[model samples]
Target chain A: GAGVSQSPSNKVTEKGKDVELRCDPISGHTALYWYRQSLGQGLEFLIYFQGNSAPDKSGLPSDRFSAERTGGSVSTLTIQRTQQEDSAVYLCASSRDMSSGANVLTFGAGSRLTVL
Target chain B: AQSVTQPDIHITVSEGASLELRCNYSYGATPYLFWYVQSPGQGLQLLLKYFSGDTLVQGIKGFEAEFKRSQSSFNLRKPSVHWSDAAEYFCAAWRSNTGKLIFGQGTTLQVKP
Candidate 1:
């Protein structure tokens, strides 16, 4: 794709329900990231994927938050037993390479999740 | 740890007025800095970045930012504000060794004609 792509631009789920958000990064990009943006709050780093290395999950808020990238092209963020506080926009970004020094990130139209 | 701070939560400017947005970062070493703009319902668009050399970096949409290493600041500026420039602006920092970016609370710009 010409740019990063995310699915289901908006989602509304009951509290405690699980939700899945998808992201498709640009072709040939080796670095991907996930972030969450809450109302009036800054973007929070969630996870990073670089090649086949173990993902950097240091920013995951809790055990309920998990993500996976398949074939190094598409990624999915899954939230189990979602809470009302989880209502936010989930953003996905990708870069050409980790060592490229051109750390310019290409972002996708985020998925707005509303946990009611 | 790397962190960014955008002091002005909201800024209002009349069309054609010059604009400036302040940003500060905390990092042990020199860090890569970036500014991004987000229009309603759209993805973040990179405005500019400061990596090395030339304190002033030019970006798209007639935006520029200067890196003040001494003050640990990288402020975004535009010579003239436009109605389309009303958007949420974010400042971010990342360690060159690690590409993870730490973003600051965004500054919302409102342009009035």
Candidate 2:
């Protein structure tokens, strides 16, 4: 793909239901990240995957939030038993490589989640 | 931990006016700085970035940013503002070893025509 792609641009689900968001990073990008943006707020780091290394999940708000990247390609972010506060725009970004010591991220349009 | 701060939550300026948006960062070492713009319902677009170079860095759309190491600031500037420039602006920083970004609360710009 020419750029990072995210699926389900808009999602609405019950408060207790689980939802999944997907991200397809730019081809050849070795680093991927997930972020959450609440209304009128800054982006909050959720998770990061670098090659085959252990993912950095330091930013996941709770145990209910989990994400995985398969085969070093597409990634999925799953929020179990979503809460109203969980309603936000989930953004995915990727960088060409980490070797440069400069990470310039290209982002997707994001998946907007609404919990009712 | 690396963090970015954008002081102004919202700002309004007349068209053709000079514009400046302030961003500050907190990190143990000098960190990479960036500015991004986001239109409504759109993804973030990099406006400019500062790695290791001259203090002033230029970017697309006639935008530029200055990295002031003494103040731990990276302030974005434009000689003249355009109506199309009205959007949400974000300031972010990342450590050299990692790809994760710590974003500041965005500043909303409203261009009054």
Candidate 3:
């Protein structure tokens, strides 16, 4: 794709329900990251996937939040038993490479999830 | 605690006037700085970045920012504001030790015609 792409731009779900957000990064980007932006708050890092190395899940808020990248091109973020606090804009970003020590990223429009 | 701060939550400026948005970061050593803009219901777009070299950095859409080491600030500036430039701006910093970018609360710019 020409840029980072995301699915389900707007999602409304009842509490305790599960939801999945998908992200398709740029054609050759080797690094993918997930971020959460709440109303009136700064973006919070959620997770990162770099090439075939193990994912860095240090930032996930809880065990219910998990993500997977299959075939190293597309990624999916899943939330189990969603809560109101999970209502936020989930942003996906991809970088050409992080080994150069620069985090130059291109982002998707984001999935706006509203858990009621 | 290390943090990023944007003092002004919202700012209003008349169209064609100069604009400045302030950002500050607290850290023992200087870190990579970046500015991004987010229009209504859109994804964030990178404006510019400062790592090393000259203090003044030029960005897209006629935007520029200066990094001040002493004041721990990276303020975004535009010589002339446009109505279309009205959007939410973010300031972020990254350090290898932290391994993640820390962002400020954001400043919402309102351009009045």
Candidate 4:
């Protein structure tokens, strides 16, 4: 793909239901990131994947929020027992590498999740 | 910990008028600053970034930003505003070691024709 692609552009689920969001990053990009955008919180980093190494999960809000990157290209973010506060736009971004140089990221349209 | 701050929650400017947006960052070391724009229902697009060298950096769409190290500020500026420039602007700082971005609360730019 020419740019980062995300699935389920919009999802509305009942409370306590689990939801999954997918992301397909640009070809050959080794760095991928997941972010959440809410009404007043702005963009918050959720997770980061760099190659096969362990993902940086420091930003995951809770135990229910988790993510995985398969084949180093496609990524999935799963939220368990969704809460009304979990409603937000989930965004995916990819970068060429993690070098000291400018790390410009390409973002996807994002998936809007609404927990009812 | 690193954080970015955008003071103005909303800014309104008349068409063809000069515009400026203020941003500040808190970091212990040199920061990699960036400005991104988001149109309605669209993804974030990078406007410009400051990694090293010249304090004044030019970006796409005739936008420019200046990095003031002493004040820890990176302000975006444009010579003239257009109707199409109406969008949400975000200021961010990248932690090179961690490869994560800290974004500010974003400023909504309203251009009046």
Q: Which ten residues in a row have the lowest lDDT in candidate 3 chain A?
A: A49-58
Candidate 4 deviant stretches above 4 angstroms: none
DockQ category of candidate 4: high
What is the C-alpha lDDT profile of model 3 across B17-61, one tens digit per residue?
999999999998998999999999989999999989999999999
| Superposed model 3: Cα runs more than 4 Å off | none
Candidate 3, true inter-chain contacts retained: 0.66
- Write down the lDDT of every candidate, Cα atoms only: 0.92, 0.92, 0.92, 0.93
What TM value does chain A in model 4 reach?
A: 0.95
TM-score of chain A of each: 0.96, 0.96, 0.96, 0.95
Residue-level lDDT of model 3, residues A39-111, one tens digit each, is 9887998988887453468889999999999888899999999999999999999988777667788899999
**Stretches of candidate 2 exceeding 4 Å from the true structure:** none
Model 2 lDDT per residue over B1-100, tens place:
5689999999999999999999999999888899999998789999999999799999999999999999999999999999999999999999866557
RMSD per candidate (Å) reads: 1.1, 1.0, 1.5, 1.1
Q: Write candidate 1's Cα lDDT for B14-77 as tens digits.
A: 9999999999999998888999999988889999988899999999999999999999999999
Tens digits of lDDT, candidate 1, A33-107: 999999989899999988645347889999999999888889999999999999999999999888877688899
Count of backbone clashes for each model?
0, 0, 0, 0
Find the 10 residues in a row with the least total lDDT in model 3 chain B: B94-103
Enumerate residue pairs that collide in model 2. none
In model 1, where do residues sit more than 4 Å from their true spots? none
